[model samples]
Target: MSMREVDPPRPSPARVYDYLLGGRHNSKVDRDAAERVMRLWPVRELALANRRFLIAAVRRLTREFGVRQFIDIGSGLPTEQNVHQVAAPDSRVLYVDNDALVVAEGGNLLDGRQAGYIEGDLRDPHRIITHPETSRLIDPTVPTALMIIGMMHYITDADDPAGIIRDLMVHLAPGSFLVVSTATDTLPDEMRQAIDMYYRNPAAPLVWRSRETVERFFDGLEPVSPGLTAVEKWTDSEAAAGPWLVIAGMARKP
Candidate 1:
């Protein structure tokens, strides 16, 4: 009898993140990836902290800036307090990612009832910006909060992440906002190396940037108070000073 081929299920980085947030949508493959990151970054707190930043940023955008529309690119599995969940009571959100597992699992979790999900790459902003389905939720003429959390590193100078950001920002109105975060190297090099190695196992590895490199993503935007800073420090009443591998900030299109 011929043996059946067993193709490894290479779960998405998004699914791995879902595991870290205590969601059940992740596969064993994703679990392995999360474990690798938790071990390498040497600061398990970074993951938790990053989530907290997302919450705070969203709240401020909704309550303070009156942003009722969102396009959360690279949103992982539908973990508790997802962007639509947090912003939904009032805001309409459209999530975009190309991971099949993420679309399948998140579909099961959200049931496509609350906010819409589209399987597309953020690198392809033109399609996302102009897609008819997305147009239903996000009107380019209105203000929106574009959440690009923890996904920029996957894109490089060759991919033009900075340019991607600029194009998206130009389409938003003055009140529209952008909350972005990426891995940094303020922590020990060993920690960064280990954390990156986890993603390195896949077809492509993540490339962490320096603070200045990340700041470039917000070049033309009017920065919110506290400016671009560490993830745990962006607009925090009492910022925690630590050598973490993540940096974050919020800015307006002006």
Candidate 2:
């Protein structure tokens, strides 16, 4: 009998993140990837903190700033307390992700009325900005929240993540918001071993950046309260000062 060829399982960042969040959508490869990263860092806690920051930012935008539209680019697999759920009932959201599984799952999870999911690459900001779902849900003339949570580190310097932000923001009206969270390069040598692990695994390798490099991604925008801070500290005034593994911030395009 001839043996059939079997392709290897590829670990997706979205699925790895879902695994870290204790979601059931991830495959075995993603679970292994998350577990390997957990050996060097508190991957699960970091994921929770990032999700909290996103929730807080979205709430602030909807309640305090009166933002009715959201474009969450690189938005991962949906879990509890999604943007449209946390936002005002009348608000509309468009969740964009490059991962096919993420897009498909998100489409199934969200109501097409208030929220929609589409396939989009972070490097191609224009396509997302002008996507049909974005056009249907987001008003370019009004303030919108543009969120890129826990995904920017996947975009290497050659991809020009800063430029992507600028291009996306250029299409939004003044007072629009930008919320971002990314891995920091402040990890100790021992902890940095996880970076190599990702590179070797069937998962997406990250390009961790210094605080300075990340700050540049918000150039020409006004920082929200607390400014750029650790993800755990972004929403909590009493959260301990960091040597944190992940950092996040919210800014407004003035």
Candidate 3:
């Protein structure tokens, strides 16, 4: 699949996110939807902060933890400094997204690269874990980093997000890592209005959680340093003042 195969008429969260990140894979509809959200809040800044956190997390995992494989669930359209690009050349990355448009665009962008993209939803952890592409690229016996950045908020409580995380963790090695970031309910009224605008779109709905609830997802895993802080504050590189809309954390399976 390629950029030409992307569904331009339908606005997807991934495409809108790509637009927010200043990537070229988004359509006019995506740009319009992104603009609507940005008008109500600093969504562009938040998204950039999230991206920076992802890069920092990847570098830390690869350089410090010596992790060599990554499974980026809900990875949107590939942009500059992707997971594979940030990790060592020997590292293997499997990018997964529920959006077909994202899969197509990512496939095109990752062509000739060692990374692989697969179309899969987060709700079904087994399907993604057992998929041929995933199995072939990732070794379950070795420590792997499972990244769920900026996407878990879409999984409503009804979907049992904690259960989903536990299910996926069961398949990983004991030393594997879980990296995640999700929107918190602790937002200003204006940002709450922006979330409302996001709900108006047909894309995946959000289920904002509090800091406590988000931390629950890391149950049984040991949190890394400076546990569960704002995305910009996760590392020293991009620290800044904030109405910190989202919380991020990384934990290791013990």
Candidate 4:
């Protein structure tokens, strides 16, 4: 049998994203997948823009809202200025992802005192919220930031993405925050077709949602200033306006 058949390394969503962000911790399979998507879409820009938004949101929560702990679900490979790095020195961060490689690599980079990593799927909020590492790093009694950035597009409607957000939010105390970023259903037909074809894998299909549908993910929460907007526009007013393929929002539990 061919080596490909003997042991094929499937492209990991997190690793592909890492590659798109120009990180060095991606495999050939991941780089190949990211380059393929890059040809079809501006995924590199989307990834960088999304990371900038994430840093801004975390800084907002830490500096403005006085939030000291964070639970970042669907967190990808460890990169510069990660949530823990952006937050205060005393703040704690719990990173969760479905990819074992991501979890393992992230765990290795963490100091273990202020940050921790767990292998958990986004669809199973209870397991993630209740995991020992989550319990150890996060205090549910105090406000915490829950970030689900750049990964919601993979959670199709059938997965009830809104319901998952609600389930996770129920565990945090009042004044906690929810930060989300996802792909918008505003891609041109040619671009959309290209993306659709690239992400046709049964396990990691992309599912773009309308702006209204994406906003509904923040239902029952108090939206931060600027509300839901394009990823680049989230924190920078000077950033060019949309037709952006990705949008982001930050909200607080009342």
Candidate 5:
């Protein structure tokens, strides 16, 4: 499809997240919705914390693991300091998301030779990781970091998110890492329900996982330092309302 078809000058996950993170690349609808969600927690730190967690995860993978490739599943709209920017510059990142607007908006931020965008849904990581275009950009033989940042809550348990992570991990090399973060219900029940109810207005059906349930996605991997902690607590002060109650972690294969 043409760029217009993909972007459509519309609202999307990427746009909504951009608004959440205080970026300028979003539509009015996105901004309004994002504001409503943040109101559920009554603080802007929620978005900043999520972005910080993502940056830390990417740097660790790039510097410590010497990883040069990434497959960011549910990769939303690209903002400043995106995965490619934080990764080794030589890194080739294949971003997959169902949002055509995300592919459109984020696609323009990259030189397709190094950073590639594919229009694919989260439930279809198989097709995304194994797609012909991704094969051309990513060398599966080398270890890759599969990122599932801040997007899993949109999926239901019936979809078997744990199985999805396992299947994706099975396709990677031994040294590969999976970096993930998702919303959890760590706040007062009313606040958690408030945020969930707000997000219900969006295109995806969000299912906030508990800390225990979130751990299930890391089934066979080695948990990195500060394992399975709240996204903000992993490296920040999430003292207020658990700062939106999101869980995040990095795990290595083998």
Candidate 6:
């Protein structure tokens, strides 16, 4: 489907994330859902922390690891300082998401740029990895960075999130980087209850994992410094001191 198609009135995970990040791309349904979530936990702060983690990881990949290609799976609505914006201007980025609104909005944001958007689901990594746009922009034999930020928790065990990551990584060259941040089940009662509110939406139910389960997503890679820390603690920025409910880490394929 093309961008001209009007999306249905369901609350999209991307739009809900946009609302949490104070972006204007969300609809009334998203805003209402976000407000409901905020009443239970520090959703805005957590979202901002995750965003900061993504920026830090991308900067590290471009500056330290010399990675010029990026595939952001489950990349949501474009916000301030997107992946391509954070990396070098010459870097190539392909934003992938199943949400129609995300694909439409991301395509608009990436207009005339080296970056592009693919409307694909993470459960089917082969489709995303082998898509023509992905092939056109990203060379599979070259080192690339993959960002799975803020999306994995929605993928339950039935979907085999670890297998999904492994399948995607198999197509990437050695030395490729994987940056991931996922929600954990180790939250307080109130926070858990708040997260449960999201289940009310027809969208995928949140599948909070334990720290051990989340770490399994990085199975074949070596963790970067300060391995699998909270999103706020992933870097030494001021945002590192903020409260975060998600664990984030960066690893390199061997």
Worst 10 residues of 1 by lDDT: 1-10
Decide which is better by lDDT, 1 or 4: 4
Error of 6 at 190 (Å): 2.2
Per-residue lDDT of candidate 5, residues 128-188 (tens digit): 7679878888887899999999889878888889988888888888899999888776556
Full-model lDDT, candidate 4: 0.84
Q: Model 2, 1-254: lDDT tens per residue?
A: 11112112777777787778777777778788889889887768878888889889988888789998998888886666768878899988989998776787768777658788999998888788778888888889999999989878788898888998999999999999999988889867666686567644445566889999999999999999888988989767898868767889999999
What lDDT does candidate 3 reach at residue 196?
66
lDDT (Cα, tens digit) per residue for candidate 1, span 1-254: 11112113774667667677777666677788778777666444666778888888888888888888998998886576788777747578888888765765565566444478888888888988888768777777889999998777787678888899888888887878999988875667787676666566465567778888888898878899776777878646587655646888999987
State TM-scores per candidate.
Answer: 0.88, 0.89, 0.93, 0.91, 0.88, 0.91
Candidate 1 stretches with Cα past 4 Å from truth are 1-8, 111-114, 201-203, 241-244
| lDDT (0 to 1) per candidate | 0.76, 0.82, 0.86, 0.84, 0.78, 0.84
Candidates 2 and 5 compared by TM-score, better number:
2
Report model 4's TM-score to 2 decimal places. Answer: 0.91
For lDDT, candidate 2 versus 6, the one ahead is: 6
Worst 10 residues of 3 by lDDT: 195-204
lDDT digits (tens) for residues 182-254 of candidate 6: 8887767788777677644445677878888988999979999878878888766444532336889899999
* Residue-pair clashes, model 4: 0
Prediction 3 global C-alpha lDDT: 0.86
Task: Supply the TM-score for candidate 2.
Answer: 0.89
Better of 2 and 4 by TM-score: 4
RMSD over all Cα atoms, model 6: 2.7
Best by lDDT: 3
TM-score of 5: 0.88
Mark the regions of model 3 whose C-alpha exceeds 4 Å error after superposition.
1-4, 199-204, 237-243
RMSD of 2: 4.2
